[model samples]
Target: MSLFDDYHPLKGKMFQILKPDGTLHPNMKPLLSDQEIFNLYQKMVFIRLADQKALMLQRQGRMGTYAPIWGQEACQVGSGSVLQKGDWVFPAFRELGASLMMGVPLKTVYLYWMGNEEGSRAPNGINMMPVSIPVGTHPLHAVGTAWAAKLKGDKIVTISYFGDGATSKGDFHEAMNLAGVFKVPTIFFCQNNQFAISVPRKIQTASETIAQKAVAYGVDGIQVDGNDLFAVYAVTKEAVAKARSGGGATLIEGVTYRFGPHTTADDPTKYRREEDIEPWKALDPMVRLRFFLKGRGLWSDEVEKQVTEEAQQEIDQVVKEAEAVPTPSVEDIFKYVYAEMTPQLKEQMEYLKGTL
Candidate 1:
């Protein structure tokens, strides 16, 4: 039998309640009430503003390098806001906004970009890892964490966030196999933003869709409109609950776009076309949320001004805090390598201190 044939049929129902034009589908109307919708809109706006501020800081040489989350606000805020405090999150390099939603301090995130090691340290109760830059490797950690949680009989789930390119990696497949065999409480979320750096999605994989890959490991998978905040929130909510309840794993493919260059150092114009991006801008996550809010008389120019100013002030404060942190010492390099430093590492540390 075909892999998909054995998996649950999607039946064209991916649980999206909001549309790009700000209209709600009947199926989604009952899932979230008006107040909840307004709250979602507020969170999306806050993340978008913070993201833009981060880019500005990078350009001004205040940040080492910044990854813009401009277009993927819905995907981050939607999935992130749903996470409970005790749940573990394994994030790739691109999940800054999501991290913030999971109670990662905005200043720590900024400090990370400013080359501070403390930025990687999660708070006491947060089960989040330092951002993973190595493509597709963190999912294995997510699987292992989930296995631990399951063995301890904890009602916790480990959600690992990665991009479409990650799915092509051997680590990703191995992680999936392990999760399936052990019934690990893990959720694999793939933000398919259509490009893995300069390579298009088509060039990244031969599969019909990234979601279909879930079938190989006996898991449920779904594709959602990443730009639609409601869709992302609802689908991820279900996935998280299922994992915590011992329903095994899920692979959610959030189809979104990167509206900016991969990083401040790269030029996207060399790879993607302007014509392709123009239309997608109209379907911007923030704009759609604004439209929805206005329809319900929850949006106003006064509120916009107030929110923008508040976000700016908060970002500015975080930037200052990040800048105030001291640089790492020579001992720092050797100290965290293990519980106890090896003689070779101790000698190297002494040599570095003398060279300085």
Candidate 2:
């Protein structure tokens, strides 16, 4: 039997640390300390509140269409927290939690969603790419960067975040193949939220699991309970260490779920039944983490109240700062496309300027 037979990446058996009831498995305890776990829990709660606040902002016309990271907090926060300062992160649109953990300001995130281009700019020295709206394309950028880092003898790992639907794209397959062959230090983090917009995972591909696809490229892959913060953190830490040690790339399939619509513009009720969401709700990452902390006497009603109030204050300030920025001019849209505008673009810019 293959060595991986017992693990069965194709079986949909997720590697979990915390059970649905917020209890840890006897043999699967995380390496994190009480303080570390408490800090992680605080970050998760903050991200969840920020996500909800973004939704409310959208409804109130304070923001453009927003992508909700309502249910994938653990996957993003755990993986993001494992990275060092030198590592690079390439995020898909829904990675607000990860970006926030990576030092992307809440105000910047809000500005991006509120249709400001400056929000896309990462602070100097922070190794994050602008959010990629195109599915699966940024993995190539990550792989290329990883390859360059490897060539330069830099011990840096690059992580690319995408949804399960991205696995079906040719760009994803090509990036995986190239990374595997070149032994590039890249981590392909796929949050398998069970749906690609309206299409369920069943229709996205024939592969039993997204992680299993890595086998074809001769790269290591694993499926973890995306809702289990400990599991996500453990697997991601292992992947980053291996990458730093020249073990090539890893594909991590985080089996997660999106509790809300794909975006503010897309309605889940049109395609999914309400019953399908209940089971996932019971396995909420924040709730399970909260339970673990409460059981350990590390959490209390007062702590909850304090954290909630602090998070609200922070998010309120972010919104205020984001809204205070002056609106972009019509000409601003034409500015970032090129260093020097092509004749055709210049003509178009001139025409638009005259119209304005």
Candidate 3:
């Protein structure tokens, strides 16, 4: 049987392959070579460093407001590793790591946070969409992409990365239903980080788990240990394979946590308790992966030091690249909104110019 069927959300089984201490069940082990695992683990370290650098840049007035993916690296990296060249990713604002995994240049990600519209443009042959800022609207966009691919007889799968808070929005449900009805190649990936800005998950929904919501849409749902890299990769691999083979969409609840605030503009301390964060820290995805690699004699303190140093150097270069970009003109904003600027947009642009 498939992993999705074996650990359905209704069955109260949160799919887990690796324990927090770096042990894994042989039966559930994913097919990854030691070198590949090491490379992926290095990527996770680089992601964390890059995320921390973004936070620092925002604090120091070097960049604009940014969302820090402090505790959710594995969710992105694990699933991202399973993606093929033709697959597409529609991400919410907080997918810097996943974007990197999907072949988006770190320079491009930095440029986007640096407020350049040019940053939204993905590289040639990379089917990634522009990052969606609206809370929960892009899942529908993923479904639409999947539906189009289905119609064209394309074998690619489309996945949407969102948060638990998004599930409360109508757009998420609409996307889920449409994907289900059409039997499109879509993966609804929800990173349930336990908070919707200041509001907690309990107030967001009455459902026991977000994965169970898939039942209403006639799709498979599986709650997963999002921090367990092996489990996330295994489950996503299965879902992507199923979708590519003409199976319908699946809703994957990556049960993870956010160590940082929702975004740089918000203060998490005002709403969350310090004690509540302690337990989640133990499940630090990178640390466990490091442990696993070390156990296999692939990683050591020296290797970590070298990897971190290389990542920081790359981040420094990217930050410089983003900063070197020429500032956009005032007219550039209104010009890029549509193919031909609407009368209303033109008027608004004129008004803004007059005020300036």
- In model 2, the runs with Cα more than 4 Å from the true position are 1-12, 354-356
Model 2: clashing residue pairs? none
Native-to-model Cα distance after best TM-score fit, residue 346 in candidate 3, in Å: 3.5
Q: Assess candidate 3 and give its TM-score to the true structure.
A: 0.97
Tally clashes: model 2: 0
User: What TM-score fits each model?
Assistant: 0.92, 0.96, 0.97
TM-score of 2: 0.96
**Backbone clashes, candidate 1:** 0
For residues 247-278, write the lDDT of model 1, one tens digit per residue.
88888888889998888888999999999899
What candidate 1 gets wrong by more than 4 Å, as runs, is 1-15, 343-356
lDDT, candidate 2, 1-356, per-residue tens: 42234445766676788998989887889879999999999998899999999999999998999999999999999999999998999999999998998898988888899998999999998998998999999999999999999999999999999999999999999999999999999999999999999999999998988999998999888898999999999889988988999988989999999998999999899999999998999989988988899999988899999999999999888888888899988777888799988888888989998986
Better of 1 and 3 by lDDT: 3
Report the C-alpha displacement of residue 65, candidate 1, in angstroms.
2.0
Clashing pairs in 3: none
